[model samples]
Target chain A: MRLGPWKIDVEYGHLALVIVIAGVTGFYLADTLQVSRNINNIILVVPLAMLLLGLCLLVVTQCIRFRKHPVQKRATQLPNHERDELEQEQSPMDLLHAFLLLLGVGALVMSYPLIGLDVATLLFMIFALLLLGVRGWLFVPIYAASFTAVVVGGASRLLPYPLPTLLF
Target chain B: MLDSSAILGAISLLGSDINIWLVIIPGLLIGLIAGSIAGVSNTMAMAICLPLTLYMDFLPAVMFLTAIFTGGGYGGAVTSILMGIPGTTSSVATTFDGYPMARKGLHNEALGLALMSSVLGVLVGYIILLFVVAPLGNWVIRLGPAEMLLVALWGLTMIAALGGKRLSRGLIAGGFGLLLGTVGMNTSGYVRGTMDIPFLLDGIPVVPAMMGMFAASQLFTLVGSQFLIKDKAARRADYRRVLSGFLSVLRYPFFQLRGTLIGVFVGAIPGVGSSVGNLIAYAQAKRTDKDPDSYGKGNPKGVMAAESANSSSEGGSMVTMLALGLPGGGGTAMLLAAFAMHNVTGGPQFINQNMDIVYTIIFGNFIQAALLLVVGLGFLAVAGNIVRVPLTILIPSVLVLALIGSFAVTGDHAGPITLFVFAGLGWLMKRYGYPVAACVVGLLLGRMVESELIRTWQISGGGELAFFLGRPVAMAFAILLVLSLLQPLIMRKFTAWRTRNRSA
Candidate 1:
């Protein structure tokens, strides 16, 4: 896959996921073992984490082997063809849209307490709508505000706990 | 098991109360709304409405709460079918086929199947409860920690089936979920994965994390789509298709029966309720089905199996609460609280002394189940319109609703934060062909798996292999688990042998 001057391999994403799992599991296992070497305490965590780590290693090895002999693997495997076909079907722009939507959701959640649930929600709505190609300046804000009001207002009244909000 | 005097007493009690009859509709509606929402759970809905039951008499209050319980059971299927988001944990399996059906422009049928299955599940569950509440309660109580651990393991087997063709990815996702599930404090006071977050002490909020993984992550992937159903012509909510779906459930009576039975047995066990019951039922359905590959790809039988188990599990959970005074799960716990409020204790004594009241509750649920068919039909008419909404509007709106729903669940920023974090992980997993459903199941059962294992170990006096041999129930479950795991292979071999023999 190419983007401007950069070449990207989608296989790296799979490898990255494996690494994240292994890293998190390893750190967690170390922390758990540090807390206690008792069988009762570590029984589940130890074996499960080790299994996960082992699986991660297995995945990493497969990725490395595949990369090392891409041509041979591509020739032998049928799933690679299917996967490549699927990759072709999904445009780079679609990936960008997904990434941007994720970023938008993250920002909304992070700013929730500071900016208030209502404001954060409003901004997120507008951002998301525009990002998803909802045009017209007046229509976007109107939809965002109405949605925010109904959800936030109803939530405030119905919920036992108060929601943090700068605007009603 | 059938007491004539109790039956007479139950009939008289039910006939005497107009208030009880009146509360059933409202209770069902409340449950439906609460259960259909992205983040709000049935238990949460019941808890919120617990106070309102104060003004009513004991019978009415109990009936109302149970009504909500029954309603919420089916309500979760609505969102699960129309959108990919399961309104409650129990409905997770519903999304497996329900969402796919929705995407295929068969949302009406899916909704209908879910509704009919849920109704029948409730009815069958209550009927079983009516006859064998005492025996079932006794059977459930005998199940020790080892048995519970086996049950959790049974649920975990679902990961293998859910993995699709990629067994390795499925195992990795499931293993990662198990690790994530154990992030908070362990049963033995060992905390490992909290990372200093306060909420981590209790463990990651399962509901919020679940919403993140299934709902938000799914929404992100839908960014490129114009609508949930891409075909504009197919997006119409046809009542005829809905009716067809409803009647179609009868075609798989055995599947529905199997699911209901699984739900009852699984639901009867304390702490393991509809959530595990639905998954186990779905797994069994998939394992037994001739066309297993059709599952998770808009198979109506999958929806029926899941809905039946989850809805019927409500009745199964009620067995412990009614006969043993033990709450099987959170919703039953709320019912027990209602029991306490009325100065009523649930146990063998309660059942022995107040058989009439027990019969009344059972009979009342029968009516609730029947009424659900009518109420659910009306509810679906309104809720089915969700498919018509364009993705441009629906995606962000649902995402925001999920965030708020998560916030409502946690009552703090932790919920929203967890939602965002898990959403990213869910998206990555989805992108790379890993099963997010497997991960969600792992996370859901992770804590239970650990606690039950620890208990089993303690009972065995430092994990002695001999300890399991002494327990026949545990041994039986182990055998069942082995058989369940190997059934696919055995079936394949048997088929091959027959084919070869035929050729000869």
Candidate 2:
């Protein structure tokens, strides 16, 4: 945990920096937000400052907590052994699959306007099913029939929230 | 003092009007359908349905909204128990035990407990809301703007207290959230980062952002994971087990009622929602549980605490939205917007001004709660198969639905863009462990806080220094704010002193 001349838990460095910045910012905001008599002065004084100071203090404390614990860092950690092991170890196949999925989702978003909700959803589902390793022409009718059911029964009949008219 | 006949009319209102019944049943079914799906949330349901409410009468319109409000909550636990994904942010804690229970072949038991727990929770919340709304409204009226602001500020402390075992990181994250919250136009009439974007003029949409962080970000993580987590949950849970859950909750009606009241009261506070309600209930349940470790697992009490608070939060959330112009949750925010579109105002006076509309909502929720209990049981029985729908079918549909939901709020492209921006920002903050709730609080409260502050100042002849304090209610709120700000420090000092004593 030590690093060179600074005999400190290296883990705490990031947390300390984050907290100091937040705490100092909060301290400034609290000062700046002092209640002023003039309406304009008070407008600048209150709310924005108090919120900032409050949030700053919040970040400062949490960062300090982050410094103290290893478990808390997992989801937010930039890259340590665990994150790298999981993320970096992805095979080229996995990379390709992920890229295609992203591309597909992006494409679906684009198609939403032209195709409309029902057609677009059906297309997205069938495409996703194929990519995820589901096989056979059997899905065509099953997909179409279920898609209709979902659109007609679920969306049209049941959903209190109506879908787009999909005039096209 | 209470109007008993009006309550009877409420009961009849839900039953007699055929169109309203049509609206209520469909709204519930749709909410159930959407909620069971991975990405469709209660907010999304409400947003999409915003337009439909435009067509209905006040009573039926509010009924449909209430149906969506309660049904969506029950729907969210579906994905949590079955798929290990919480459809709503509120259900994050559910997965801790629910998913595990499902994996252990206790799916029926888990689903059973969660369903029953949810109904009981909302039922209790409804009952509490029924009694407390009048007295609570009186209390709220007595409070000043300063106190309201203080309550909002108190909410921020939750970040530092609950973020993690660490104190500093929590504050930093909260601070960053508050900073980002100010990115849009401020109360000062100065456009901050909104610069040229007209949509940005309104400030960041926290709902889209929250959904992005909680739902969309999870999709990224899910994409990263090679396989969808599946469950081989047990096929059969005896009716006895389900009945026992009811018996157990009934045995401790006081606890359930108390928890429900807390959820309602908490929910009525502007900017607080079911997520806060859920966590507060979790903490309370854990604190009071004889065996604390059993909570994070598949304990019935754990399920009971979360579901009750979470469901009850709906009633709590609506109380403010319908009774006071302020909103307690995303659904309520959208609801307030609906009221506005229809030329309705929502506040304590709104109820006084429009008792017919208000009474309809108050009584409709009670009837809906009882109905949802029956409907929820049927859904829970088959939710295993119902919730088994793949994310592949789910994601694209949700993407389309999110677009539809956002657009339904405003029949234009701007709403979708707001949804997108919020989604992206939500994903980033959630990834980095920032609190999205604070940002939401800031966004929703930002305008109101600004207006209220300005109003207070104007009333004080621009003498802003002591203007807020001059109002008796505002002064009380100011005191609450100071106390809230000091609480963390006080607790920290106490904890430190205790540790030092232990060491000695």
Candidate 3:
């Protein structure tokens, strides 16, 4: 189940299943190879199997352990002072900012190759402006124009960019 | 003297000369950017830039990477101070108290402490590398597989030493890490775990895995908690607080020296580096303090211990790189990759033959650290304001950059996909309390150990116990490994007995 400050959230069950599948598939592949019991190879395989098994075992242990102790009950009745002290470890603002940043970065990454770097930068800038709660098309073009200047001026001079051709 | 100078002239080369000012600024700038973000490590920055270096001349490329290295070192302190999330492994211990200080609005003091510690750590580590690396390089070059194995084992055992009182978990993680590392290839021409995925033939790329483990897991945690957060902090942000905070570094050199020594020694060891060093130093500082309980509760000493020690380790790790032809830490490994690309053979005689380039590296470290101190302080003063950028645009753009950063290496979608794959696995590992970094380090050092073992085994015709343990130096290291593995167990039993006796 839960170990110390770390908990094996129920959601990781899917991941555990995936690992099990991977392990089995790996075992199957090892068998399929039809390799003889070479000492060195066995030395490698045995450890790999054990490590995977250990990971799976640990995950399973977490799920089993926490099922016996719900989060609310555990938090309220915790005997240890340290665990009690860690009750409000994460703040909402921290999580939100991280997600917003993650989402923004994810979107920009998926779109980069489709549009050229400059266009991508301009569009991402608009999206970023929106994330910052700034509404207005006025800043959009200004953002693009300023970014374009920065990109062109900066890249041509300061950056070590390779083969960044502009599509007129 | 002239002949000596000629040889020195040949070796002091850093790389193909590039625009110095342009490179350092960008390097520092990117490092600052990356370091300020949680889970984006200095190593990730290096890996992302690895492919880019193939195109540039050597020195500029090296300079750029070095800049990122310097900048990344200080950048981690920002997130550690502002948010609980460590921008790097090194900064993890800082979160014990740094974030609490920020929450109390002593943000300037905490930030200042972090900056000072970082600069001091860097200065000390660099100085050590300058004096120690060249002298020891000759002897270290003679370290065979046996010695290297001992060194690797030393790194492996650090988990047990620093894992708080939970020594069993640390040992289990470390042992399991070694096992995970055993996947894929062996020195005897056997590919045990390949199973047809050609990508795994070379074993797992620890960098991508590390990113997944450390970076992606944090992302998943962020995602899981999404939509529950409210926007606060409508008050005006101040830059002066950031400046006065940085000025405090000059005021506290003792903290710097203590932290630096701890960091450098930890860093010099082959496998471990800033994170472990930082944690150990912080804990030690706490244990020795008059008010030990003050730690993990907004103590300035906590921040000083962690930040200074973490930065100091960077220099120690470099010493291993220069003297022993060993990569000190993950960052040094990246440096090694760059050296390899430049045909820079850095074994025992490297410095003797090429003092200029060698000295340049040492001097470059000082210059890099000096520049990073200024850069980090300046950014810490202003980076808080960066939060206002719209998520919509910044998200998509950064995503592109991250993807490009990944793909730029292998030149395929595989790299980005690999990044995500690592991220997904990392998420699972974190949720289940699996030792993420331990597994990665195990995997990273695994192949190297096996390769050497097999080489040594074959070299000695079946690796007889006598041949393996024959050399005195080799025997010494092997003895160290045995003791390292046993010490924790002995200490635990001794403590338990003492407690029981006292109870009786």
Which candidate leads the pack in DockQ? 1
Clashes of each: 0, 36, 32
lDDT, residue B269, model 3 = 61
The sequence of per-residue lDDT tens digits that candidate 1 reaches over residues B1-504 is: 699998999999999989989999999999999999988988999999999888989999999999999999999999998888899989988998999899899998999989999999999999999888999998988899999988777676565545544656777887788778888888888887788888899988899999999886578778778888978877887899999999999999999999999999898988878888998899889888988878878899999999999999999999999888999898999999998888999999999999999999999999999999999999998999998998999999999889889989989888999999999999888777788877887888788889999999888998898999999989988887777656656877988999999999
Superposed model 3: Cα runs more than 4 Å off = A1-36, A51-76, A80-168, B1-27, B30-69, B76-111, B160-187, B224-259, B262-310, B313-367, B386-404, B456-504
Q: How displaced is residue B408 in candidate 2, in Å? A: 4.8
The C-alpha RMSD in Å for every predicted model, in order, reads: 3.3, 7.6, 7.6
lDDT of 3 by residue, B136-184 (tens): 4445556666676666666556544443334444554455556556556
lDDT of 1 by residue, A50-78 (tens): 88888788778766532332343453465
Candidate 1, clashing residue pairs?
Answer: none
Best by TM-score: 1
Interface RMSD for each candidate model? 1.0, 7.6, 6.2
> Residue A112 in candidate 2 has what lDDT?
57
Encode model 2's per-residue lDDT on B1-504: one tens digit a residue: 456666666566666677766676777777776676644677777887888888887667777877887888888887777655566756655665676566555666667677767777777676666666667666655555555555555555543344332444445444444444554455655554454667766766544444444445445434433224354233444465656545566666655665676667666666546665665565566555666546545665666666677788887877766666777667888878877877788887886665555666766666677787778777766776533455555554455455454455444445456656555544444445554444444444445555555655566676566766557755665564555445557766977999999999
Query: What digit string (tens of lDDT, one per residue) describes model 3 on residues A1-168?
Result: 467756545655545644653465367346525564755555444555555566455645544434444456466566665573455444665446545645554554455556655665566666655654556779767865586556534543533344132542
Candidate scoring better on lDDT of 2 and 3: 3
Give model 3's DockQ, 2 decimals.
Answer: 0.15
